[model samples]
Target: MKIALIGYGKMGQAIEAIALQRGHEVVLKVSIDNLEDNTIENIRKADVAIEFTGPESAYENILRCIEAGVPVVSGSTGWLDKYEAAKASCTAHNSAMLYASNFSVGVNIFFALNQKLAALMQPHPEYDVKMLEIHHTQKKDAPSGTAITLAEQILEQNKQKTKWVNHDGSNASDLVILSERIDPAPGTHVITYTSAIDDIEIRHTAHNRQGFATGAVLAAEFLQNKKGIFSMSDVLGI
Candidate 1:
């Protein structure tokens, strides 16, 4: 498959390496300085475009790809408020698009485990739930998108908590989400169910960014000739 890459950053380079290893050609690579290279002519030439840009620019990037009649797979986060608009455009143009907060296969499994554990702990009010996520110091979004998705899943299973509170070391009883941005940590998420008896904790730690890059490539491969908005679950059939 011929691929166009938007955002030639660390993730983009990683994805390119894996795509080449998987026998895919990267026809266009757009970086921060190459705004003119992201034109419709450039985008429409590829079989698919994989986007790993920032939240501020992800929505526009996907729209441009759709206008070019190209399919897209985006792993950008914190721009979901504009997702409905993007979905509408894709539908009107009959373009294929897939977006995921975290594209790691392990993270997808962790999502499934979170759902199951949430359901299991729903009736057990004795346990209190909280989540903590740590990422690289350069990560822009607080709490990480994976943490927000996990918190949403927990809320779906347990109706008692209406919202998530980003813990500021305050003594609040609400469902708390704690975020830590440290030196070069790939990603780490810990969800705990605590009570008087014991504490049940589930965590996913990434050794490096290869898993995320691999998953994005898989999504790009799976999204070819497919239509509508999709998630990692759609790719994994979970």
Candidate 2:
């Protein structure tokens, strides 16, 4: 499939390498310096667009793709407040979009495990759940998007947690998500359920960006001829 990379940063470069290795062509690459290359005429040349840009620019980039009728696979985070608007635009334009907090295959599986654990611990309100996520210092979003996904899944199944707070879960109903940004750390997300008797923990660690890049390409492949909004669960069939 022909692909367009909307962001030419580390993640975008990694995705380009994997897409090329898989025999896919990257037709267009848009970076800060090459903003003019992100025009509708240029975007229409590709079957799909993979966006790994930052929060401030993600919405506009995805919107441009949808407007150009190009299927988009976006792994950008912290811009979810505009997700509904993006979905609405997609439906109106009959465009396809697949968005994920973390596109690593392992992270999605770990997400499933977290939901199940939350359900199992739902009836037993004695347990308290908290999450911690660590990423490279260059990462812009705090608590990481993956951590928010994990916390959301847990909150859905475990009624004890009505909300999530950063760094502090002193309140009984609050699910605390601690974040750390250190140099050279790819990413790590850990969830712990603690009770008076014991603690249960589940974690997912990424050694590099390849896993996420692979999954984003896979998502682009899945969305090549599809229409409507989708999540990683739809692409991975989770």
TM-score of each: 0.97, 0.98
Q: Which lDDT tens digits does candidate 1 get at residues 1-238?
A: 9999999999999999999999999999999889789898999889999999998999999999999889999988989999999999999999999998899999999999999999999999888888999999999988798999999999998866778888754543467999999978999999999999999999999999999999999999999988888888999999
Q: Show where candidate 1 strays beyond 4 Å.
A: 169-173
Q: Write model 2 residue lDDT over 1-53, tens digit each, in one string.
A: 99999999999999999999999999999998999889999999999999989
Q: Best candidate, TM-score-wise?
A: 2
Per-residue lDDT of 103 in model 1: 96
| Candidate 2 TM-score to native | 0.98
RMSD each, Å:
1.3, 0.8
With a 3 Å backbone cut-off (N, CA, C), the pairs that clash in candidate 2 are: none
Those runs of model 2 whose alpha carbons end farther than 4 Å from true positions after fitting are none
Q: What is the lDDT of residue 112 in candidate 1?
A: 98
